[model samples]
Target chain A: MEWLQNFLPLTFDRAVVWIGVLCTIAIYSLLYRENPFYRFFEHMYIGLAAGYSLGPLGVDILYRYWIEPIWVQGYWAWAFVVPFGLYLYFIYSERYGWVSRLVIGLLIGASAGLFFQEFSSRYLVQLNSTLQRPLWFSASNPDLTVGNLIQNYIFLAILLTVMTYFTFSYQQKGTVKGIATAGRWFLMIGLGAIFGNTVMARMALLIGRAYYILSDWLLIRVGG
Target chain B: MQPQTIWQKMLAVDRRLLYVLLLVNIVMFLLVPVRMPASISPPVQKFYDTIEALQPGDLVMISSNWSASTLAENQPQLEAVIKHLMRKKARFSIISIEAQSRDISYRLAERVTKAEGYEYGRDWVHFGFVPNLTVAIKGMVTDLPNTIKQDVRGTRVSQIEMLKGVNSLRQYKLVIDVTPSGTVPIWISYSPKEVNIIYCPTSVMAAEAYTYLDSGQIKGMVTGAKGAQEYEQLLGIVGLASRFTNAISFSHVLIITFILLGNVAMFMNRLAERREA
Candidate 1:
């Protein structure tokens, strides 16, 4: 044990950093070729993440919310909560399959109720904002600048075209067909933009790992 | 002897070699001591102004729900925001809906707050990790203390000096959500209307947030590392985002170049085959 300690980084923090570097390399090695080293580390990483979450779940959620309330605070009503949640596992039972549906039904009902508030609060504000957009310049609205007016017009046009594209109630024809085609083009452009951003996001995650190796492990100072 | 053509070689280049090239490009740029300035976007400016509007001793809730996976992007945003809040003398509390983020954000906030001479329970506190964000936010809207119950240190929120008279979420002035997840919709739906919201989403998540930004539901946004770099410029500080920006920008250039090269190679190969035919 003493020899092992001496062989490793002296401080716990440094040891953790070393372990992180090793794990990063092990995982990235798969980019070259599939191998046992990469496989082992990949599984280990997933397991570690899942295991790490249990600590917080136990301390923060279970003990703090459920167990403590029942045992210490004498909230007897809370005692049934865990067992009731456990009924979800009855999904595998041949005879007791109906037991799981109770939990599923309760969850669906709760979600449905919550979604009512969610839809109203979430969409209504957006609808109000969209409708309230000033299409043309007005003297009463002093804040409406030329730039804002133009932007609002562009926004209104795009909104109308996009909404028209999604209208499947009637077959599109003539000018409506052209407008729907324009909306489809607009949607493709939006999707392309999203794809570009997704690429940027993935690149950032890669750069982050590379930065870690250079700065933290190699002790190199990066850009200011 | 048929010599290999440049187009043939380019088409058949090993993917591993490309990965190595990218790695080297990133490392080389990272080691350079130069800094590139970022232009401030309207969303970032609005985000800065919203925080600047906060008065001293005003309460703010920081919903930090990102983990190691997004540390590069989210950390700089969180650091810059916290520094600005501390500068404003605003008392704040952090809560994490993500289990892994609990410890990560706690340690990060501790490091940041400690440097600014901020006291724990007096100036700021961590409410720790909660399992469900939607339910928690809804509950906190009605009863803050009962919903959160206690701080990370096991101190009852009612006893915390900073939380005095903060009976509900309505008492808070701002909710800054730094996340890579889709939790902003939940906050908008459940949190108090009077309290404004600022978003810090990863780049992939930012495009979808524009509608919300247009709707005024989210007052402002900082999009990923690029956005963080812009925010740091606005604050006149050189933070992680600035350090990581060069590599990010250069990497994009490299990827785009390879994409163009690949297309050109494909066209050349097809032409050569036609000539042979």
Candidate 2:
């Protein structure tokens, strides 16, 4: 702990405090108006991120999809080279833009095939299971707590009401209307919860930035 | 409509004021260090317990799929989990779907694991980023060697000392996912049924996971930064997650206050309309 305390030379760490203070000041300039310094870093952050992502991405695509085939598999896998070569030609010739579509089409097809199965298994199965639970099941046998029982009943209600809200099998009947009305209330609760969480998350981000300013910069120098 | 009250009028603060006040709260708290114990959510506790109970030499698969933006939350969770694994002497491998996570988690793991003298390639190997999680999982399931030709640095996976006997997901005792995305389902869907899958989702990502948590599809979860803190407590190590969550918990209280205030303002506005009518 003491080693870390003195790890940074006092002069060096003090110098760090100065730059941190300057950045803190620039960050507060965000309060006044958009300045070049702020915009510079903002765009630089974006550009750097894009560069980082694209660099690895370029290497991965060229290595896995192109170079590996040529180097490892040799001329036997050369058939893939033509379309791959064609996909790269769109930059030089506008007419070859359609060739890029072939690549896009394959991407879309693969995505669709995967997502179709995902959509069914995740969404459909979940929805169906929501509809089929036994309403009368006890939460606890001997060891089951009252809290467990209440949770089960609440789940049962939410399931039935929410499902009925989507039902359109026949003209609204008495039970159906009651269920639909219940679903509407449940929907309101759900929406409110979502909105609350969203606000919390937004505030969290702001807090993080403010933290960088006050704690990392100001407090560090002053407290030290 | 009801008559408007004075307190109710105050509730209708401007949206910008709400935002500024939030920024202030964050700034105020960040300057101060407060340590508060968290109410351990079931899933988070389960995640902690699982790692705590692991025996030495157990193999774990860690899928880290978050990036720098989520560093405030996900970084702490990754650090705590890795620290726990190191303490347990667990042999592990990390693989990522996102390219950034591959580099980030690799560096993070190397730093923490090195502190414990846990040798890389022998104890833990980073397979690094793959373009597709599903295809990778399928390949790792059916044929580990054919799918992953090389590690992140172009070394063969077969040759990596950590994965010497690890042919498939079935060989790993636990699969821990630290992500802010919905990639958990892919693991549940593709990984072998024999291996256990646990989760670490951002706080906002936790609610949707209750459905899976209830069904036992995911064995447990460490939710957001707070969950990371509880895990730190369980391990007897205070780290960044605990520090960050102090602000988060207080932030939760602040947001709740504003919501109530807003509702009060809306109620008053309705009452004023009634009175005018």
Candidate 3:
């Protein structure tokens, strides 16, 4: 082991990088064919990620929020917080599963309350912006140029068509059916754009790993 | 009795071979000395301007919630944003909703700030990881010190010099959410109305955010590595994003080419089968 370390860049940082490179290779081996090496690394990666999160959970959350207050600040009531949270695990009990609903209900109530503010803050502004769009050239908002006006009209068309497609209350007529078809086409285009971006994002991840191997591990200077 | 048709052969090309070809293409682009400039998108331009408008000593909250899986995109965005904040002499703190991000962002910030002489407690801090951002943001909006309680190092939030007078989330001027997750809506919904938000999402998450950007809920955005590359250009510094941009651009080209070829092969194979019939 000592000789192995000596033969390679054996410093702690370098060693970690080497291990990471090996892990990367092991993980990528699955692309060729599923093998034990890939499976071992795959499990190891998941396990390591789970284990690593415990450090922050303990130090940042459990210790800072729970333990320190109880021990140093003499806040005895803080101790009950964890036990109360543990009631969620009561869901596993066949006999007392109803007890877990208390926690779930509390969470749902809190989330529902929070969602009111979320709805107003997140969607209202968008609604306002949509309504405030300058359909034609206006003196009040001089910056709303010709191009913006055209774009706004296009936006309105798409919004109306898409909304019509989702309107299930009435039987769509001939014109309505055409608009709904156009809406579906628009949605497909939007989805294709999303798929394109997704491909780019996935490629970036692969490129990142390759860059790590070539530049970090091999000490190859890539890109000026 | 006869040689295989070109379309049949093309259709039958091994997926492993395609993977190897893609790997080679990426490696070649990564190693190539050439650099392709990025056209600054509206979102990236807005993102740059939003940060550039920040005055010195103004507090900024960075919600770094990306793990190692997105290091390629998020790392460059964070690095560029941090450097920009430091250059402006802004007081900033990072909070991570993801546990892994807490350490990764902290270490990355430490490395970046150490070179720029930004002090830990006085100039910047890491609030560590919180289990939930919605709860944390709401709590911090009401009582920042009581909610976060302490920094990652166990130092009380009150003791941290940068947060000396900061009592609520309203005191912060900007919130930069660097994430591959959908936590931006929570920040927008729950955080104080005064604090403007900017987003840095992975490319896949960027499309959904356009509506938010259009509405001014988020002041700006940087979408993945390509966005980062544009941001680096605006900053006038060649960083990891700039380095990765060529490979990123070429990989898209490779994928698109393959898709077109596949379609052509399919069409030709169908035509040949019709002729045989």
- Give each candidate's fraction of reference contacts reproduced: 0.80, 0.15, 0.86
**Per-residue lDDT for B1-277 in model 3, tens only?**
3439999998989999999999999999999988998899999999999999999999999999999989998999999999999989999999999999999999999999999999999999999999999989989999999999999888999999999989999999999999999999989899889899999999999999999999999999999999999999999989899999889988889998999999999999999999999
lDDT of 3 at B2: 41
User: Can you list each candidate's DockQ?
Assistant: 0.74, 0.26, 0.84
Question: Which residue pairs show backbone clashes in model 2?
Answer: none
Residues B13-64, model 1: lDDT tens digits: 8999999999999888888899888888999999999999999999999999
List model 2 lDDT by residue over B143-182, tens digit each.
Answer: 7765776777778778888777667778888999898788
A212 Cα displacement, candidate 3 (Å):
0.7
Q: What lDDT tens digits, residue by residue, belong to model 2 across residues A93-161?
A: 687678777767877888888786666645664666555544454553455666766777899888779
- How close is every model to the real structure, measured as TM-score? 0.94, 0.82, 0.97
- Sorted on DockQ, best first, the list reads 3, 1, 2
Best by DockQ: 3
Each candidate's interface RMSD: 1.1, 3.9, 0.8
Q: Which stretches of candidate 1 lie over 4 Å from their true place?
A: A1-8, B1-5, B267-277
